[model samples]
Target: MTSTPPLRQQCPPGACDCHRERLLENPDADLRILLLTRNEEQRLLERLENLKDLADLQRMQQKLQEQLGIRLHIAPGFNEVRTTRGIEFDFEDQPGLCRKTRQAIPAAIRRSMEKNPEIAWRLLDSHDLLGGL
Candidate 1:
C-alpha cells in the first residue's frame, strides 16, 4: 500500500471555479427528491399516453368489428401510425397476436394500395415505404 500524503496549505471556497460553487447540483436529499418527482411525472405521462392509445384502439376495433363482423383483439400498448397509405402497426407481441394481426393485414394492404397505387406488397417493410432510408 502507498503512504498517504499529508495535507498542504488549505485553499478557501473561491480558490477555483470548479463544481464546488454550482447551485442545486449537489447529490443530496433535494436532488434525490427532484429526480424522483421528475420520474413520477414521466411515469404519469406514459400512463396517460397508454390510456389514450388503448381507448383509441378500442374505438378502431369496434369500427372494424361492425364493418367485418369479426372480433380483432389487439394487445395493449401497441403503437400505431395511420397515414394516407394505411395503418402502420408496431408491437412487441412476438408470438401472441399473429393470428389477429394477419386478419387485419389484407385489409390494411388494400387500403394502402388504393390510396397509393405505387405500393408494392412484397416491399411493405422496405425503406421506400417509410419515406426512404
Candidate 2:
C-alpha cells in the first residue's frame, strides 16, 4: 500500500494575516451601524417581532444550504445600509425606507442584533406606548 503525503499548510498573505491578528486581538475594534424606520407605532413593534423570526429562519436556511448543498430562494428585498457611523441624514425620505422590503429588514436586523443586541434593544425600547383608542 502506498502512503500519500500530507497536504501542504497554507498561510494567508501579510495584509490578511495582519487583519486576522488584529481581529483576534481586538474583535470589537470596528464600529457597526443599524438603521430602522417606522411609519406607524404598531408597525414598529411588528417589525421587531418579524426581525427575530426572520433571523431564526435564515439561520436554519443557512445551515441546511451548507449541509445539503441546497439553494433556497429567500428572495431579494430592501437595501441594507452599513456605515462606521450610525448617523445618516438621507433616511428621512420615505422612498429610502419604502425601498426596503419586509424580508430584508428582518435579516439585516437579525445580523445587526446578533452583533450588537444592546443597540437593538435600546432602539426597540425607545418607542412610547400608545393609549387605547
Candidate 3:
C-alpha cells in the first residue's frame, strides 16, 4: 500500500499569496534590527553588571529576547561571530570590542562596548568565557 503525503493549504487561485507567504517565511524579520541609544546602552550595561552568574545572564538573555526581540547567544572563549544583522560581543581576548562580519554594527552598541571594556569583561567572566566556549 502507498501512503499519501500530508495535505498543504492552497491559496485561492486569483489571490497573490506571495506577500503572505513571504511574511510567514520570515516571522522574525522585524526582530532583525538591534537599535540602542546611549542611555539605553548604559542601562543595559548596568543590568549586565549586576548579573551574578550564568543563570542570571541567561535570564538577561531572555529579557533581551522579550524586550528587544533579539536572540543572544553566550559562547565563552570562542572568537566573536558577527553578521550583517547580528552583533557579537567579543570578550574572549579583548573585552568591549564590537567586530562585524559583513556590515557594521549599530552605532549605539559599538559605543557601549567600546566605552565599557571592564563591564564587558565582567559579562564574559559571568558566562565563563575565559574557561571555554
lDDT of 2 by residue, 78-108 (tens): 3332321231212221211222332344444
Which is the winner by TM-score between candidate 1 and candidate 3?
Answer: 3
C-alpha lDDT of candidate 3 relative to the true structure: 0.43
Residue pairs whose backbone atoms clash in candidate 1: none
Give the alpha-carbon lDDT of every model.
Answer: 0.35, 0.35, 0.43
lDDT of 3 by residue, 1-133 (tens): 9984332233355542223244336755442222343355457766665555445556766776676554555443345523212335432221112232111223334344455544356556566654653
Cα lDDT of model 2 overall? Answer: 0.35
lDDT of 1 by residue, 1-133 (tens): 9984331222245543213223234444122212223344345334323333334435645653453233454321223334323434343222112233343344453444454444332233343344553
Root-mean-square deviation of Cα positions for candidate 3 versus the true structure, in angstroms: 14.4
As a TM-score, model 1 comes out at 0.21
Model 2: which ten-residue window has the lowest total lDDT? 87-96
Those runs of model 2 whose alpha carbons end farther than 4 Å from true positions after fitting are: 1-101, 128-133
Off by over 4 Å in 3: 1-35, 78-133
Query: Backbone clashes per model, in order?
Result: 0, 0, 0
RMSD per candidate (Å) reads 22.0, 17.3, 14.4
